[model samples]
Target: MRSIAFLSADFLANPWPEYARFRAERPVWWADEIRMFCVFRHKDIRTCLTSTDYTVEYPFRVSRQVFGETLLDLDGPRHQRLRRPLAGLLLGQRDNIGFRAAAEDRARTAVAALRPDTELDMVRGPARTVPLTATATFLGIPPERHDWLLHTVEYLVSHLDGSSGDFARASALRAELEEYLLRLISTGAPARSMLGEVHSWVRDGRITAAEAVGLATLTLAAGFETSTGLISNALHCLARHPGHAAGAASDTGRLRSFLKETLRWEPPQHDTVRFARRDTTLAGVPVPAGSALKLVLASGNRDAEVFDHAEEFRPDRSTHGSLTFGHGSHSCLGTHIALDVAEAFIGALLARFPGLRAVDDPMPPITGSTFRRPQALRMWLGPKGES
Candidate 1:
């Protein structure tokens, strides 16, 4: 027994190996330092994620050091009530087709702008640009404000490691965002777009001003980052497995399988945290109420018991679904939209640049947070036959 942290680098860089080891020995082990039960097996993870006894601690007292107490931290009825209007905005079928198509168009335009033989930063290019542009455009935010919004999201995400200065900065940004929303609400901005619709929700009391800002900020913060990561990670996976990419590029069936397998292989949110709502037992291990449990979603996705040759990225492989987006009532609201954007981006990229290859200099640095992603990914592009 090593008696060290379970899912540290030994796991993040190549989790399947560690998960196989842990799931075989201590599927449910308590981290004394973190004061929570760490579960690595697929079945145990699924049980914890889907269980009502566990709850998302809002404003994540710990994560508030970075993300603040937003909807991501809320739970139960309050979380549901707060999420209703936003859910309506994201899930409503009213104009979803138009919006979805518009998003794809925006992605296509971004892809078309790529210059030949250039090392494009996926984070700054299509990954960050497409979603931010599409979401901001949909919300009717002024084109000029996109830069400031992206900067804000970048600064906020940087503060995730409990930096005091970062929190102070995020606090200021949060206030500025709230004030901005309040003024928009006070002036009764004409309902010009979805962002305006969010203000309308506030004005009509469907959501509070704070809630509205949180929703908006969350949209800005989470929307682009995760959506971009999904495409980038999927591409990285395919590039590593040329056969899988080729398979998916030719067949929609293969594409669907690729999506599932990619998610299982490298989910955006590598781990999800929870502060137990009350004393609870997870698969027989006792977790004290309020203890922070790190459910290794990425680790769980590759559990050998649930997924054969879990370490391998095989698009055609069949098995239970991954908990990438999450499970239970508090699952991601924008998951479908995220999937849509990802599929569109990958679909377009493969169709346009079948010879896409990763750049030696721009391979993104693997991160060490609950969310697993490269800091940036740059790829070499060439004519169809060049690579």
Candidate 2:
């Protein structure tokens, strides 16, 4: 392993320029700070993602603490078994009319509550509420428990980012969340919900009760946070390019492309880690067993070899796909649900507030190293008559 200096704080705040440099100079290099081999190029990252030699079993200390042993930390048949039932339910939910309509209704209601001609924090308004509501509704979380669920999810996500100062509080919250889920399962409330489905799997001896808790925790936390980031990031992108927002408002195809471009340009979760199970060569660099590879999905999305004008956010740009939601076995199961959430929220926002514009001149800073999104999107809602 080749050791190098730690990445600077500024690079973590805004990493694209640094990523460009790495792509040009050393696309694959070892950083001592994180103790992981960082892969920058698209092809190499894709290769690492699909390769059987690399597994997602790298020690994600915070995730393990908060979520227990989830599918994210498993590999081989064990991972497949845990993922199968949940994946089937999620895939089926994607095409369910009731689920989609409920999501749209939630998005519409959230956006409609914002008064025109007033500045609003998009994060606090639609971005945060829509996904939380949608996920809870789909998971069959009771209305009374929605507030608790949201708060717990936020707390869990903070720990998942691995930078939270209050680990003790996060640990307490994780315990509380687990207990709450166990009770919810026992009560048999929302018996037809995903949690109920998971409980059924447990009864059938497919997985343990603890595994069910973990899967439920994973669904509640992962489902909401990433979806929240996607909505917030997409809004930030649209605010920066008003013309695209206008085009997207009237054209469904353009709106879909706009969301795709946002995913490519500023993916919510920046990178994911994988552990080398055996000796391997990545981009011709020798990787030893038990080494961690930080697959920079954000960098791969902007690789010059794969994308033209890689730095610019052009909604109309043609593309095959981006690594935003990852690839292969560990690809996001909620990809379709996330896209649906974005479509519903963006469509509702554009319809309700025709001339939405960013209130901050430069806009709020996008933050986080492991996870990235606008801290808060302050936007001015144009008068009802304005277009």
Candidate 3:
């Protein structure tokens, strides 16, 4: 058995093979580079997400270190207090005339902006733009400030890969965001959006103004990566399996299954970390309390023990327990909206454009260790059979 340098250039560039090897040989390996126990099996990864022995909140969680005491950095009651009401409001907007319509409108606008005659980078065009714009709409951000929101999220996410200048830029960005969001909060609630809800929280004294800013920032940054990844990833899946393209576009059921398979095969948020609440054992390896464990969700999604013939991309495969979205309490709050965005955008792309495909057969490779997505997907959008 070989030791896994989980963050090595080789692994980060392409990790599927290492994930398979690690799951088979050392399901509970300790990664010396990051100084944490890496859990590769499906069950163990699920435990890291859902079990009482492990918690997403602790002094050492990376998110906490990055964004400080934001809503994403909280645990249990405090987390729920801020999230539950907001989640309820968000859910209410899930219906057609509400949140779903907002998502659809944003997605359609993004799709309509694409010019098929010339090559277009889908990731830069629709993938990133739709989510950020949709999120701005949802948060009631003003039209003038939309560009700031997009650029800020770009840097906020870039910090995860330790990109140069991102940390300092993040600091400056956070201060600017504080001023902007606080002003938004002061202007009073707008309709029934996330920003409005946070404003009410500040007014009601349920949370401080600074806490409200943290919460807004978290929500903005959170939805950006997930939806962007899903859109681009779904496109890649359809392109790779051209046989399934027309059928999925015409049929809603096929499209849903297609998205499900894409989520499992190439999840955007590849891995996440959890800290032990108490002394716990994962895959028979002892893990002391407070020890950090890296849950390889991408690996778990492909665990053969969990999903039969998992290595292959079977669009029809049952993806019931897939960890494409993190499981349990920490599951994505914007999941419903994200799905709406993907279905609308992908649906529009297929139905209106007909045979949509990558300009190149392979497309750009999915990149990033944390938020895995094609940085660029230059596409040729035309009638069926053009590609």
Candidate 4:
């Protein structure tokens, strides 16, 4: 079997084949170039994520310098203390009927604005707009401030995959965003929003003012890019299999199954890095303390032993709860909201344009090593009045 380099551009473009080979031969191997142990199989990846020995703290110098110490860097009680309030808000928002209604309305408005028989980059149009609008709504920001929120979130996400020069600009943007959040908090909360809840936390002295800013930053950044990527990916899947679009619009159950399969087949966040808190063994391979381990989540989603005919994208296939959003203590807090936003946007798109289909053969390829999605998804919206 050929040795796999995780950082190779070729692997980034199409990693499934290489991941298959690795899962078959070497499920766990150390890559000298990157200096991180790569964990590939589904079972092992689950263990790596849930095991008490590993941590999500930044092991690399660059990430630590860039992101600073946020919730991702904490462990034990501190991690729970920081995470609980935010998790409560997110869960409440997801369960709130008012929030869901507003999200669906925004999604419909976004879809209705699109013109038919014209080439449209779905990523920029509905895919991007819907999530931004929903996030702004979640924060209780007025329409006038939506642009600022969008730009701030976009700048922060760009830095996640930025160069050295970009880091300086990103740092400036981070400061500005934190200040903006602080200002928003000063004005008082909107009666029915997450920002309001966070503001109350700050006032009660439960969380410091600085922690409030950090929590807001994490909420916006986490919800923005991942939600956008999931929407774009789901739409791309529907376009590839145009036959499914109609069923998705008419049947809620079928639509959900399609979305779940999409999550397993092409998750937005591909891989996550973790550090060994102490000298430990993973899959019987000894890893020294402070060493970095790259958990290939996309690879785990395709582990043949877990899913029957995993390589193929079958909407009806049973995923058995894939590790796309992760598991255990560090699992994503926004999983329910993310799925809701994606469902609303995709459902609106299908209902609005039942005959939607890809404009180009093979379409655009999904990219990015850390967060993955189509670079551009161009599709035709059938005729003017056919919907």
Q: What is candidate 3's CA lDDT for residue 344?
A: 83
Q: What is the C-alpha lDDT of each candidate?
A: 0.71, 0.82, 0.80, 0.80
Query: In candidate 1, which residue pairs clash?
Result: 58-73, 59-69, 139-195
Which pairs of residues clash in candidate 3, taking residues 3 or more apart in a chain or in different chains?
A: 93-99
How many clashes does each candidate structure show, in the order listed? Answer: 3, 0, 1, 0
Clashing pairs in 2: none
lDDT by residue for model 1 over 240-339, one digit each (tens)?
A: 7777788888776688678777777878777777767788887678888777777878878887777788888777888466778777776777776777
All candidates: CA RMSD (Å) = 3.0, 2.4, 2.5, 2.1
Cα-lDDT of candidate 4: 0.80
Give the per-residue lDDT digits (tens) of candidate 4, residues 241-308: 76776678788788988888888999998887788889998778899998888899999999888998
Per-residue alpha-carbon lDDT of model 3 for 1-387, expressed as tens digits?
777665577767789998998888899988777788988899888878888888777774556555666765667888888777667756674332266777889887877777665677888887888888887888888767778789888877777654566566677877787788889887854846677777777889998888788777777887788888999988987888888877798798899888888889999888887888999788889999989888889999999888999999988889988987788888877777677788888988787688566888666788777888887888888753221
Q: Predictions ranked by TM-score, top down? A: 4, 2, 3, 1
Indicate the worst ten consecutive residues by lDDT in candidate 3. 89-98
